[model samples]
Target: MCELLGMSANVPTDICFSFTGLMQRGGRTGPHRDGWGIAFYEGKGVREFRDPDPSCDSEIARLVQNYPIKSRIVISHIRQANAGRVCLENTHPFMRELWGRYWTFAHNGQLPGIRSKTLEHYVPVGTTDSEHAFCWLLDQIRERFPKPPKRQTTLWRFIHQCCEQLRELGVYNMLLSDSRSLICYCSTKLYWVTRRAPFTTAKLKDADVTIDFRQETSLQDIVSVIATEPLTHDEEWQRIKTGELQVFKRGQPC
Candidate 1:
């Protein structure tokens, strides 16, 4: 299985603190050493960095750790390959254009017979069942709504239904976004934490590091982080229920 990390913020915020803890799990602190990738949304454009190497040892991962790329939405993954070879194409956080906007997806689990499900439009560029499931999901959305829907809740509910269908196939924990909304679904384990005004210091569980978010954020800022596991030892992380779907916009759950 892989690990997922996502962020939705009211204001553009860097995920360096949380990402630092997650990277440690790639090889140093955990066994997910197959590969890693991340996608950062800036307006209508998305910037992605991927490597077919353990995130803890990758120089690119170090650069991302050092650089503060502020974005309102971010999705990242660290893989422990189960269905695909350890290559760049098999890396998580796959990106594809949808409805005039880029949709980014990162999955943490597998579907053994997912490829048997026929797809209409989107196609996987890799062999991973994770990527195939993502393509099939987008195909379903495109089939249901040829154009973007007017009511956002309708789209959210439809996406949840699609996820529930996929969940029936196998473990389907995932994070998806279309540059505006962050969607998370949990089949087994997932957790989230939101930080806002009156922020306090947070200590990482994987690394001996602490950050005082008050010094880095404003009173009006709201930032929510979703991860496969709790990244911080000091902060209270809410566990998403099994088979539940969550939609977040501007750092608030919808």
Candidate 2:
């Protein structure tokens, strides 16, 4: 299986710290080394970075670690390549324009028989099952609402149903975002941790890295991080139950 990492914050924030821990695992500390990608949502615009090379040694990955690129929503992935060949197009955190906003998606598990399902409005440019599944999901969403829903609850329900239906297909753990919100679904493994007022130190488990949140943040900052595994050894990360979907908008959502 691959790995996922995402962030939703009340205020503009950078994911460099957490991303550093994940990069080391792309080929050094763990096995997910096939490819990697990340997307940052800055208002209505999106900044995406992808490379088929292992993130452990990618120069681009090194730059991202040093860059304090800030955004309200973000999604990232490190792939193990169970269902796709290693290529630039096969990388996760795929992007597509929908309802006038760029929606980004990243998947963490394999799906069998996904190739048999042909899609109409949305089609995959990459051979990866993850991209196919993302296109299929967008098609379902478009069918549910010709345009973006006017009500928040209606849209939430629609997104949940689409995820539920996809869950029936195979392992479908995913992270989706459109700058305003981050929708996460867990079919097998996922975990999350939130940092808020009275922030404390978090020590990375895969590297000798630690960040004292208090030193770099204000009381108004609230950042919620979701990942395939806990990034820190001391922080209590909440594990998402299988078949669960949660939306994080402005750092909080049920």
Candidate 3:
């Protein structure tokens, strides 16, 4: 199975610190290294990078780990390749245009017996089942609301119903966003931890380094980090129960 990582911040926040730990799982400290990709939402522009190479050794991954690319909504994944060829087109964190905005999606679990019957507007460029599922999900959303639903609860409910439909097909742990907030649906393994006032140090389980966010952040900072597995050894991460959906904005789950 692949691994997932996501960050939701009330303000534009850098993912460098948490990304360094996730990069270690992409063929270094963990086993998911077939391919990798990440997305950083910067207003109307979405800066995304994908690599077919193992992130543990890829120069691009190294650069991502070194640079502080900030975003309000971020979705990232480290692939383990259950379907599709090992190529850039098959990487996770795929993007599609929807409701005049670029919607991003990434999946962590394998969906069995997934095949494309037909697509109306969007099509899958890659052969991965994950991409196929993403396309179908986007299509469903567009079908339900040709225009964006203004109410948060309405949009959230729409996604909740759709997630249940997908889960019936197979495993559906995922992170989805549209530059505002993140919609996290956990079918299996997923955990979340938020850092805020009275912050403490966190040591990466894979890396030997630790970071004290208090030294680098302000009093109002509240950033939520979500992953397939807990990244740090110290923080008490809240694990999402199966079939539950979480909405994150400005780094806290609501």
In order, candidate lDDTs are 0.93, 0.89, 0.88
Encode model 3's per-residue lDDT on 1-254: one tens digit a residue: 89999999877889988889998999989888899999999986799988988999999998989888878888899998888989999998999999888989999777776663356778999998888888888888898899999897798899988888778878999899977789999999999998899888999998998999888688898999999999999899999999999999878888
Q: Rank the candidates by lDDT, best first.
A: 1, 2, 3
Error of 3 at 237 (Å): 0.4
Candidate 1: segments with Cα more than 4 A from true spot: none
**Candidate 2 lDDT over residue span 2-61, tens digit each:** 889999988889998999999988999999889899999989999889899999989999
lDDT of 1 by residue, 66-149 (tens): 999999999999999999899999998999988899999999887988989998898888899998999999998999999999
Q: What's the TM-score of each model vs. the native? A: 0.99, 0.97, 0.97
Report the error of model 2 at residue 161, Å: 1.5
- Which one is best on lDDT? 1
Residue-level error in angstroms, candidate 2, position 90: 0.2
